[model samples]
Target: MALRMADTPTPVRHHRRSRRSRRAVLATLASVVTALVAALLAWPGAEPADAAPSTFAHPGVTVSRGQLDFTREKVNAGAQPWKGAHDQMMGSKYASLSRTPKPRAVVECGSYSDPNYGCTDEREDAIAAYTTALAWYITRDDRYAKKSIELMDAWSGTIKDHTNSNAPLQTGWAGSSWPRAAEIIKHTYTGTWGNSGRFATMLRNVYLPEIINGSNSNGNWELSMMEAAIGISVFIEDKGSYDKAMAKFRTRTAAYVYLASDGELPKTVPSQNLDTRAKIVKYWQGQGTFTTGLTQETCRDFTHTGYGLSAISHVAETSRIQGEDLYKTDVGERLRQGLGFQARYELGEAPPGSLCGGSVHRGLGPVTEVGYNALHSRLGHAMSNTQKLTEKNRPAGSNNLFVAWETLTHADNPS
Candidate 1:
């Protein structure tokens, strides 16, 4: 007979059953794995969806698109405060189209001792480029965009390196502006920036590497370098560089700006080997009075102190744009205290003789807007001294080193 009652063959039947069992097991395993993966992805500690984005988040870096848009809207409607600030910037020589570009192969700047040729020129050009870019963004004028592009292109096309004692500082100054201009233009303007790639390459090769490692000369040097590194990291969407720069920035800021809660001495970078109190005190310019808002460079001069403060503000602002709210952290507190303390002196209050030997070299510069806006406007903190100074210096301009046109960009900025 062809078929039997017990079915075909015992071995064949067993084999078919075994195959079906295997298939069922495999399916069950796959389902379990999928559920586990989904759970993991939903976990709080899961990896960020985009640790780094290509274009950076809108209003990314230091100034966000929202902030820019607000400025534009206010200026267009002829609002009181922003309109006046914008008018001041446009009237300034920084926004002038007649500005010239001076590019060099190697920029060498000594420590206020011997500044090489093209050092000042390159820094000013970079600032002018940023100023023009801001003008373009606010007014939607093609000429401003074109001029900004021209200035950036000139530097990218010609400059290859930075050298000398002031190289890092010079690089920090020029480096600070380059990425700001590039970020605004590359993201906002529709015009052709054919050399954008070259510009990116310039930042990556020439600027990022120089400042990414940071400096040990002074608080300002390292702070400014960190500012450059942070800005460039945002432009290039370098998550690694961004994290590294931010870590360094936090450490340096803690050390640079002091608070009474920090215990007996200011926080010190372990890499700097400032473990001993003697070394720390000396590094702090022989100032034993560790009060709130006293900076490491306070004994040196308010000008240098302003540099450190400016970098702190810039980094904090950029961090906020990138989605981290550092303004409420110890960083922000230190900044607020520092600004207020310095503002008191700048507002004509006589610094105590015990402080900085009563010879506080004062010239706080245009460094208050960013911190003032963050601490006062955003957080609703009572920053009486800072508010006074910031309002007094309406339309704050550039320090010609790194800071520029902060009043126009950050004055009462809700964003």
Candidate 2:
């Protein structure tokens, strides 16, 4: 009596059976995919999915065109710090119109630059190029743009490779500035750079190959390397390299800056294999106790610690210029705490002997401008110590490495 559709070999029954089978197969595939995705995520050092920007902003390496325009307006209006900073930069040897560029086919650097061959020259030339580009933007002077182009062309034609122990770090330092100059000159400067493609080729072949993969050395080493890689990728518009460098920046920032939430010890880089607490403490420069703002290099010294912070700020600033506000994220939080901690000590606060054996080194360098500007000016964070330290060191000039003229570019800059 219940002669259903299954009793008869009808097309409807066959269709129903087929539909049920398809649903079962689909469910099985979904389960398998979930398991595979979970496994891949658990795997160490697994590369993250690509998240490159679909359309990159021009002149978007550590500075935006709008920011440049704003700075120009401020400088033209005879503003306090902007005008002073511009004058300081213009007076520096980097902005000299008759400056020369010294490029080598090979650059060699050792620990602390023992055998420094072409190391200082490369770093200075790169900073000079960036300075001229900034000058061109602020003054609308064709001479500055041409000068930047000339410096870039000289290096591109000459430099073939970087060699030795500090090659990666050296490349990272120089690489950071070159892209800033290139991005500004190429996108904003009206003057022609006939050899711009050659410069791009040089960066792609020589510099990118050296630092794109990042360093496994000190946290500062990797931080600087990623800084260079991020800027270079934007200048070259290399999407893959951009993604890879951003990933490295994120990971290194977490491991470099400690937060109270990161358990008793600081977070470790998986590649560094800092599995045990003992290994982590040793890797953290013998600093056993972890604080919210303690850096991996705090016990090592504050100078290198400053380097790490500067790199983080530069990369975060670049990301912000490219339509992402990293200053509003955990990156911003770490930067604030790191700056505060270093600033408190640099302001001559007596430590409790728990930090850096109670004798932490000073001289935090010209690394506070960008971070202070972003966190305090834009996001409105109350940083009395950072403000005091930043104002005390106004008109920050070239560190002779990567950082240069930050006071001019980032002081109270909202954009």
How does each model score on lDDT?
0.85, 0.89
TM-score of each: 0.86, 0.91
Shift of residue 291 alpha carbon in model 2, Å? 0.6
Q: What's the lDDT for residue 317 in model 2?
A: 93
Q: What stretches of model 2 exceed 4 Å from their correct place?
A: 1-48
Cα lDDT tens digits for candidate 1, 105-167: 878778782866788888889888888999999988999999999999999998888888888
**Candidate no. 2 TM-score:** 0.91
Worst 10 residues of 2 by lDDT: 1-10
Tens digits of per-residue lDDT, candidate 2, 1-415, equal: 1211333234565898777766776787777788888775544323355646788998999999888988999999999899999999999999999998888999999988889899999999999999999999999999999999989999999999999999999999999999999999999987688998999999989999999888778899999999999898888899999988888888889889999977777876787788899998888888888999999998888899999999999999998888777888778999999999999998899877888788888888999999999999989999999999999999898789999999999999988
Candidate 1 Cα outliers beyond 4 Å, as residue runs = 1-55
